[model samples]
Target: MKNNNSNIKLFIDGFKKFQKKHDNILEDTAYTQQPKAMMITCCDSRIDPSLITDTKPGELFVIRNVANLVPPFEGDLRHHGTSAAIEYGVLYLGVTDIIVLGHSNCGGIASLFSNQNKIKSSDFINNWIDIARDAKDRTLDRCKHNSQAEQINCCEKESLLISLQNLQTFPWIKDKIDKKEIYIHAWYLDLASGTIEAYNSDLKEFIPL
Candidate 1:
């Protein structure tokens, strides 16, 4: 415990405890090769999809990224991890519901308002975050008079809507949606209050769920 090597040993010991639990999870998941639902959620350490949903292993096919932004369908790109995961979940795994889950105090959404290109130091992050730039633009355009906090809140919610729209850009997804084979959902998690809200397309608002 006195040196860096000691710290590494302590970390490994903790990991061993986690591994024991993971082994049981693996056994439970072995029989369920395909998940029934898919979720796209933020890459925040505080937000654990399974824990939040009270789901066990193999219950959800999850794709996580900064701000949970889903890019529009584009064939020009050779590799798209989010889209690839979605395609596999929908087409291969036959997932019926896809949820885009956004959370409060997202660094990626906050960086959208920063003067400097915050992610420039990390090229991949900068480029990936550009996918949700439209949401940021919409927020700025409509909330010019609102407080900074309100604007950020609007952007966070709008980003979920943007991802829902982006989901439609995939022809397969669109077809599944049209056929009622798949359903899309948007959600926002307010960390301060521990309340989760689901978007009501019919009501055109977010409602507590």
Candidate 2:
């Protein structure tokens, strides 16, 4: 909040540059959007899903949150940000493909893996993170002998699968999938190595891209 604090100004400056770069597409996105897909990814500063996917403003509808998480639809009236976006994409936008993207060194997953005590004070953060506890538990149960880093990596990948599974709990999405109208995908981004892997159900593993 000091005069010397420049991140806000830096973002403003970056927006000006971005405006100059993409002013041409502004009109197209302003009137309507026909994005090819929808993506749920982390809120990490380093993970720019659009840039990574080489997509412009209207190409992909995106929902970002801590750890890129999605909770199963409970048929309640609460405002679930991730679920709302998913509904809008599938029901309104008619997005054929939905992707749940996870990244390495994810602070959210890492926090679930390591910092449970620290987040207990914030009710929402604590409860939201509890969604991925199963992923952590599964990874630990299966990889008892692996090192912490390897276990964390396993947890990260598994959590993406968990979200993919959770997507099926939404009736609309499930119906679309059952009728072959839509598809769900899982992607893992290894920021340290700058590579991506896509989940293959047949292979039961992520294949490098």
Candidate 3:
């Protein structure tokens, strides 16, 4: 953390790869952007939606925040970064799907159950992490006998479901869901095993994707 600016060279190197392939993509999407999905995920360095999904530029409209949490819809208009991105991606960009992608060993998720050092005292992160409080509660109640690791894994996935429900709290999102214009999905990535599990609406469980 000494030299925070040191990573710029890595980005510049990545951009070189991007530029080599950008010409063909820019030929069609330079004028308009039509991403396939509005994807919400965690800001963890290990989880990159584009890299995980094997998607190119203009393929997915992604929004990342701590724990990939989504707040309940409110009438008040303030600086809601994640919500604003969701609105723009869904309403403005006309994305056909919304994905709440969660992952294992998420630090934000661990903070929910942490008692060693308070992780939610930060100005914005504390209030932001509050959105997942219910998820932590549910995990504790459901997985009380499980190990800490298992509880966190459950909580991580539970947070995804909660966010998906919160997405429905937005009138436009609900209307679209009702009208069959857009669909919501939950996915869990196990970084250790390199396996992805998706929530099955019918069975009400997570299954390997």
Which structure among the candidates has the greatest TM-score?
Answer: 2
Candidate 3 lDDT at 166 equals 97
Per-residue lDDT over 32-133 for candidate 1, one digit per residue giving the tens place of the 0 to 100 score: 677879999999988899998998888899999999999999998588888899889999999999999999988888788875346646858877877888
lDDT of 3 by residue, 85-124 (tens): 9999999999999989999998888888876235747977
**TM-score of model 2 (CA atoms):** 0.93
The residue ranges of model 1 lying beyond 4 angstroms of the native Cα positions read 1-11, 19-23, 115-117
| Winner on TM-score (1 vs 2) | 2
Model 1: per-residue Cα lDDT at residue 46: 86
Residue-wise lDDT of candidate 2 within 102-195, one digit each (tens)? 9998877877766434554675776887788999999999998998888889999999989989999999999999999999999999998999
Displacement of the residue 121 alpha carbon in candidate 2, Å: 3.0
Off by over 4 Å in 3: 1-5, 17-24, 116-120
Rank all candidate structures by their TM-score, best first, as comma-separated numbers.
Answer: 2, 3, 1
The 10-residue segment with the lowest total lDDT in model 3: 114-123
Clashing pairs in 2: none
User: What CA RMSD would you report for each candidate?
Assistant: 2.6, 1.9, 2.5
For model 2, the local distance difference test gives: 0.89
